[model samples]
Target: MERQKRTTIYDIALKLNLAASSVSRALSNSSKINAETKALVLKTAVEMNYQHNAMASNLRKGSNPTIGVVVPRINQDYFSNVIAGIEEVTYSRGYSLIICQSNEQHAREVDCVNALVNQHVSCVIISIAAETGTYGHLQQVLDRQIGLIQFDRVVDELDTFKVINNNETASLEAVSHLIEQGYRRIALLEGPQQLDIFRQRKAGYLAALRQHNIPVLEELMYENAWTKELGAVATAKLLDLENPPDAIFASTSDFSALGVLEVAANKGIQIPKELGICGYSNEPFTELTSPSITTIDQYSFKMGKTIAELYFEQTEGKAQIKPKTISIKPKLIVRKSTRRK
Candidate 1:
């Protein structure tokens, strides 16, 4: 089939009896063009279905006004809010965003990064996949002189700009709250330890135990139990124990906490009285769940905006800016799930 010709500035110029340069300048919203002429050109261009050749324009300017974002899952509340926040700033700056989801796979994450690099994006913002082990893919971004911003699940070794929640401190506060509520023998549902965020959360749990002079029990800790199914399984196993925990901390996510609540309800366990529950991420469903879950609010949307602002700040100046980490302290939201009184 023959391709339909795309409307060009020259076509609009010819129809309006104006110079092509004038049409081009008007389309670009140049200050040199008169308002009346610009308005007329724009109206004519719109009538002709003329689309701006951003790619060609960017190529000539030696820069692409596009930001690429990679996350584990787009459906998740935290990541979605972050993306919305990023778009908020980039849109105002006349920049576009290309979002990709890795589905927590290393290969998919690498592929997404490579595709973005090939597109010559201005910057890449990523939260490393749960299965990520190698830094070579991230290094390639730096080698190409592309701006890299790592948020949440970051690789500590890479010298990239990072925006992250204080996972350790938030976890500590959550666990401590559980302890203060008269719930001893608190259990922990942990995410993959390969990621630093999970490791830090585990550290926080341990620190809280130490502070309270409680012995750290190995059996109470379950690894790779970040999902609802895994959390339910872990909860069943813990409840079956001869010396079961009084409270459970789903340090991985709120979904895991929901699993705990479901399993406990099935077994006729009373939340906060017989079994207290707490979770992380402060997901919307947490508040809606029966008895409501106590959780940590990571300010995910704010974190994303901060990440974009940080990138702009770093790139705006002429002087060399060193890679830096910006830590946003998370807040512990106490609810009926963990309130024993």
Candidate 2:
């Protein structure tokens, strides 16, 4: 038996007794075509199971109808939620998202950016990896004139559109909260200072201490304590110090804060009374811990939406959108861990 031929506009036009040009124009929704004709054309097209040639449509509009999203790790709660928010808006606008993960490496991040560029993606959204300090790869995207929008963990050197939380402000608030609870000798577990976000957080902690008239203790600050194990190591060292800190600002992320809590528990240190703790990134697990961790909510999903909408506004030739840095203020989520008795 012979295979059936695919349906086309000509077939629909023949059945409806309309000219092919009229049918095509109606299907394309040309404003010149009458509404009744368009409705009839659409109804007939649907009945004929005619699949619109997406490639032809995109070429005509001079767009790929796809956005490229590159994250350090898609498994992480923060990145995953951000991607979801991007999908929510882009899907409705007839755009598809092509996602890539960098696995927290500078080399991989560069590769991902290059891959997206090759695909001719209309826009590229990124949350830079922890190890990415030199932003030549990011600059390449900008050089290519691709719409590049960065969110959450972003590079500061690149003068591009960005949707980011006020990391320094959030860190300052967290430190202030700790100080208000009478945590005088507060130690900080910092992530890699190479990334702008972590660097801002570290600065915020220092500023808060200065504002409260607390002397800067160089010994209490540990740089590159980005992981749980590093947090545990930092905690051990801090606790062994002649003047151990009464509180710990785990500015790295919630994982680091969890380490602080676990180590304190093992050492028979009571929370809040003996050792106060605070974290960043408001991870879900932070709330379920024995004494819920005090953290900063960066509104990750909203940041993603903001990035997507900004990209569209810039790419679609809307009113001249300026290349301005939009900062989303983070909220301090106080929990039992940081509460003073």
lDDT of 1 by residue, 1-341 (tens): 99989999889989999999899999889999999999999888888899999888897788999999999999999999999999998899999999999999999999999999999999999999999999899999999999999999999889889999999999999999999999889999999999999999999999999999999999999999999999999999999999999999999999899999999999999988999999999899988988999999999999989998998899887988899999999999999998876
Candidate 2 residue-wise lDDT at 17: 96
> What TM-score, over all chains together, does every model reach?
0.90, 0.84
Which residue pairs collide, candidate 2? none
The CA lDDT of each predicted structure is 0.94, 0.89
| lDDT, candidate 2, 77-97, per-residue tens | 778888998999899899999
For all candidates, the clash counts are: 0, 0
Best by lDDT: 1
Which 10 consecutive residues of model 2 have the lowest summed lDDT?
54-63
In model 1, how large is the Cα lDDT of residue 252?
Answer: 95
lDDT comparing candidate 1 with the true structure:
0.94
RMSD (Cα, Å) of candidate 2?
Answer: 4.2
